[model samples]
Structure formats: C-alpha cells, structure tokens
Target: MKQLMDLANRDPLARRWAKNCAFDLMFGVGDDHYQVEVRGGQIEAMRERPSKLTSWDFAIAGPQSSWQAHWAPVPAPTFHDIIAMRTAGHITIEGELTGFFANILYVKRMLELPRIEGWLQ
Candidate 1:
C-alpha cells in the first residue's frame, strides 16, 4: 500500500488529484478493511481493520471476488474499473463524495497499483 502511494505520488495527474487532499479513506473486501489517512498529498498511515471504520472521507467496499478481479494481472472488463464494478452491483461507495468524484482517476490508479507492481494474486 505504501508502494501504491509512492507510485501515485510520482504521477503528475495523481499529484494534481491529490492536491489539498487531506482526509481518511478506506476500502473493504469481504471482512477486511484498509483504512488510509492522507495528509499534504501523501499517505500518512494505513491500518487493517475488522469493521472498526470510524470517520472517513470515502470508502469502497466490495466482495473478495470483485477485489481479486480488480487486482488481477489482467482484469476482466467490469472488474477493471470501480464504477463498472459498482454498476454491475459488485461494489459500493460511502461517505464524502466530492473528494471521491474529484480524484476518481487517481483513486482508481491507486487501487490498480497492485497490478502495476505485479503484485497480482
């Protein structure tokens, strides 16, 4: 996850999307959640949780299969994008939406880090 942030930080688009982005966000797959805190355009911390997600800027939650597909080395069509997954009834979004919508590309890029880094499972 740190590597994901590091990669995103290097991208001009990502940096632009992250400008003034200071908030806590999280995503869930099945029973697990990863809460991430961002400050000054960089990741402050990320912690694993079991539904103890308190305040957050946004959240992306989906089934394990959906997450697996999203992280796949070569994802299938619908799983390749967050909105597509949501459209297909595979994922859900919650919390503040302005930031989420504004930095959507960057957020999607972050979620695709595992694939870009060849950390596919």
Candidate 2:
C-alpha cells in the first residue's frame, strides 16, 4: 500500500484530481489497518493505525479476502467498486461521509491504483 501511495504521489493525474482534497482515511484489511493521510492530493503518509482515539475523516474496512478480490486484475462483479462492496456486505464504511463524498472520485481512484500496475496480482 505504501508503494501504491508512492506511485500515486508521482502521478500527475492523481495529483491534479486531489489537489484540493485533504483527509485521513482509515483502511482495514482483516486484522491490519492503515491510516492514509492525504493533503493537497499528495499522499503524505501511510502507516499503521495511530491509536484508538486518532481522528480520521472516514474508514473503509473489509476482510483480506474481500480486498484481494477487489484488487484482482479482473475483479468479479460487485468486487469492482467500494459501494458495491458495502452493498454486498463485503466491506464497511463509517465515520463522517461528507469528506468521503466530497472526494469520492479521489477515494475510488486511489484505492484502484493497484489495478493500474497489477501490484496486487
């Protein structure tokens, strides 16, 4: 995931897309969780969840299996999207939604970055 962020930080398109966005997104894969901090469209940090009381704009969590499928080169139906994963009960999204919605495109594109380089495969 750190690699993904690094690559994204160097991506011109990604930077442009998220230029005005800023937030901390908590992403969980099974028992592990990461806090991805974004400011001005650049991924400033990707690290383990800081603490229970750490403030985050929103969170996206799911089992390892769900994420594996979602990151597959050719994701199966419903596994191809975050909303679909939520609707399918494969993942849960919580916390403040305004930030998530406001930068929905960036969130989706950032999560899908792995697909571009086939990193998860």
Candidate 3:
C-alpha cells in the first residue's frame, strides 16, 4: 500500500488530488491498521500500527472483503466509492470528519491508487 501512496508523488493529477488536503488518516482491515500521513501532496509516512497512539483527522475501517473489493481494478456498485460503501454498510468512517467530507473527492482519488497502479490485483 506504501507503493500505492508513493505513486501519488509521481503523478501530477494524484498530487493535485491532495492539494491543500494535508492531514493524517488510517485504514483498518481486520485487527491491523495503517496510518498514512500526508503533507503538501507527499506521503510522509505509511506504516502499520499495532495500536492507536495519536488521533487522526479521519479513519476508515472495514472488513478485508470490503478492502479487497475497494482495491479491485474495477469495483462493483457499492465498492466504487467510500460513501457508497458506508451507505451499504460495508465500511465505517470515524473521527473529525469535516475535512474528510470536504475533500471526499480528493481523498477518494488518493485511496483509489492501489487499483489505479495495479498494486492490488
């Protein structure tokens, strides 16, 4: 997944997707979680955490199936978007959400990199 994050720095469109959206966030699958810190369109850190230490602007969690479907090259219906997943009860979002909701498009695009780069399939 770090590879997917790193790809953003190399993509003009991806970098732009994160413009003015600096913040820390995490993704949880099963019991393991990973934090991704972004600053100025660059990923400062993307590491797995045993447990939460500090807070995040937002966090997204779901079952491995949801995550896998999300990383599909072309997802189906509910898997196509985070909001869709949440609406369908396949994923959950938490924490300070104003920033996340405001930049949902950018955040969504950033999260889609795993599939965009063919790193998941």
Off by over 4 Å in 1: 1-13, 50-53
Estimate candidate 3's RMSD in Å.
1.6
Residue lDDT tens for model 2, 15-73: 76887899999999999999999988888999885788878999999999998899899
Clashes of each: 0, 0, 0
Full candidate order by lDDT, most accurate first: 2, 3, 1
Runs in model 2 deviating more than 4 A are: none
Off by over 4 Å in 3: none
Stretch of 10 with least lDDT, candidate 3:
47-56
Deviation in Å, model 3, residue 4 alpha carbon: 2.0
- Using all chains and alpha carbons, the TM-scores for the candidates as numbered come to 0.83, 0.93, 0.88
- Which pairs clash in the backbone of model 2? none
Candidate structures ordered by TM-score, highest first: 2, 3, 1
Pick the lDDT winner. 2
Better of 1 and 2 by TM-score: 2
